[model samples]
Target chain A: DTAVSQTPKYLVTQMGNDKSIKCEQNLGHDTMYWYKQDSKKFLKIMFSYNNKELIINETVPNRFSPKSPDKAHLNLHINSLELGDSAVYFCASSQGGQGGYTFGSGTRLTVV
Target chain B: EDKVVQSPLSLVVHEGDTVTLNCSYEVTNFRSLLWYKQEKKAPTFLFMLTSSGIEKKSGRLSSILDKKELSSILNITATQTGDSAIYLCAVINDYKLSFGAGTTVTVRA
Candidate 1:
């Protein structure tokens, strides 16, 4: 079974269009995270949710919002997407304390 | 601010050669260090080191952490073409993990 999965492995949209990426994890983990990887392949944390509660929110633009309905799901919603938002977004999950994360395949978003 | 830095942004080596990837960090409230191997898509976890001077090994891959120096090294011996991938190092502080830019490794057969 896939531990962490994200929907729409690839997304191509026009600028100013809104899109959402859904993520789910079956690893029975407590903490989940959303990360953005740019063209340079530098992975930066965007948001973190623990047990469906927001724990960390990086200085990402206000257009990006993360919604965690439950502990097993964390979804990212982007409003008024801009060209700079073109990047690969990854979702990952991990248990509390001393464990590495399991990352989703990732969603490659391209805004034209 | 927490930061993780990796050395030798890219490496190329012949098969059967050994390579060492270095990772160093500076962060407050340090928790653990993790190594990941990313082939194309998602990164796969390789090892997690929380203590100093203890070596973690798996087959041809081994890693050790030095908390005093705030650094860690990942060693891959008898590397094969299949071992080619981007190695990423991450440091956990509180609940967030700060990731390095990653080191790309290419093994030629």
Candidate 2:
């Protein structure tokens, strides 16, 4: 079984559209995070949720929202997507605020 | 702002060779440093360094952190073609994890 998994591994959509990516972790972690990797392969943290509560929110646009239904699930929803949103979105989970994270297979979003 | 810097953006090496990747960070409330290997899809955890001078090794990959220098290094010995991937370095502070621009390693057969 996958420790962390995200659905729709590849998503291609037109600009101004709305989409959502789902993530689930079977590792029984208490914290979940969403990261974006641009073409430069620079991974940046977007949002973090601990026990279904939002903890850290970077300077990401308000159009991007993260929802943690529970400790084991965190989903990302993007509204009115832009071209700059074309990148790989990764879902990760950890026990708490320490240690290495377990990442899921990224969802490649291509905005046309 | 928290910063994690990875050196030599990319490298090309031959099979049976050794490769070293460097990472340095400046962050508040530093908790630990982590290394991940990204191939085609996800980034798989390789090592997590919390204490300085203690080497963590797994198979052909090893890593060490130097808190005095605020840096860490990942070393791959006897690297094979399968060792090719983007190596990511991240620093954890508080509830945040800041990442460095990954180092791409290409092992030629």
Candidate 3:
């Protein structure tokens, strides 16, 4: 069974548009995170939520927001998508406090 | 800045050749170090080393951490073509993890 699952495996949209990527986990994990991997394959954390509470917010732009309705779900919404937003976004979950992560298949976003 | 640096960003070798991937970190309040393998998709966890001088092994993969040296190494013996993939090294400090650029390994049969 898939432990961590994300919606919209691929997304193609125009610049200045808004988009959202949904993620859920079945591992009973309390922590969820969103990460972005650029074309160079450098992965960086964007946001982290634990028990529906914001824990870590990197230098990500204000246009990006994360909402966790519950412990099992964490969704990312990007407003005013720009060309630089095009990348593979990965959703991950863990039990928190140094637990190993289970990552989703990733959503490839293309902004034109 | 807090960062994780991996050496030999890319390597190419024939089958049965052993390879060692290195990772060094500079993070405050270091908690643990982890290794992962990424093929054409998402990365899969390999090992999580929290302490120094402890070796973690899985099949042909093995990893060990050196807290004093602030580094870790992943060793693969008898690497096959199927073993070709990007190996990522990440360090967790509190709730944040700094990932290295990753080392791409190409194993030719």
Candidate 4:
């Protein structure tokens, strides 16, 4: 069984369109995070949720918002998607900010 | 900002060669350092180092953290073609991890 999983493995959309990538963890962790890996392979943390509470929000634009329905799920929603938003979005979960993250396979979003 | 820097950015070597990847960080209240090997899509966990001078080894890969120096290095010996991937180094702080611009390694057969 997969510990942390995300769906819509690949997302192809046109600019100005809005889309959402869903993530869920079955590891019974209390914290979940979203990271974006760009073309240069630089991984950057976008949002972090600990027990549905927003903790770390980097310098990401306002168009992106993360919602944690509960401790087990964190979803990323993007509005007015731009070309710069084309990157692989990774969903991760950890025990209590102490353990290493268990990451999902990733959702490669291609903004056309 | 917490910064994790990895270099040489990219490297090419033979299958049997030994390569050392470097990582340096400037993170406040750094607790640990992690290494991940990212291939096509996902990044798989490799190793995590916390104490200085203590080495963590798994198969042909090993890593050591120098907390006093704010740096760490990952060494791969007897490298194989399967070892080729983007090796990412992250500086783990209290709650978030700051990642570097990974090192792309190519092990030629």
Q: Which candidate wins on lDDT? A: 1
Give fnat for candidate 2.
Answer: 0.93
Candidate 3 structure quality by residue, lDDT tens digits, A1-112? 8899999999999999999999999999988999999999999999999899999999899999999999999999999999999999999988874758889999999999
Best by DockQ: 2
Determine which window of 10 residues in candidate 2 chain A has minimal summed lDDT: A94-103
lDDT for each candidate structure: 0.95, 0.94, 0.94, 0.93
Fnat per predicted structure, each in turn: 0.77, 0.93, 0.82, 0.68
Q: All candidates' TM-scores?
A: 0.98, 0.97, 0.98, 0.98
Give the per-residue Cα lDDT of candidate 1 at A83.
96
Docking tier of model 4: it is: medium
lDDT of 1 by residue, A1-112 (tens): 9999999999999999999999999989999999999999999999999999999999989899999999999999999999999999999998873466889999999999
lDDT tens digits by residue: candidate 1, B17-54: 99999999999999999999999999899999999999
Candidate 3 error regions (>4 Å): none
Q: Is candidate 2 or candidate 3 better by TM-score?
A: 3
Interface DockQ per candidate: 0.78, 0.89, 0.82, 0.78
Choose 2 or 4, whichever is better by DockQ. 2
Lowest lDDT 10-residue stretch of candidate 4 chain A? A94-103
Candidate 2 per-residue lDDT over residues A1-99, each given as its tens digit: 989999999999999999999999999999999999999888899999999999999989999999998899999999999999999999999989797
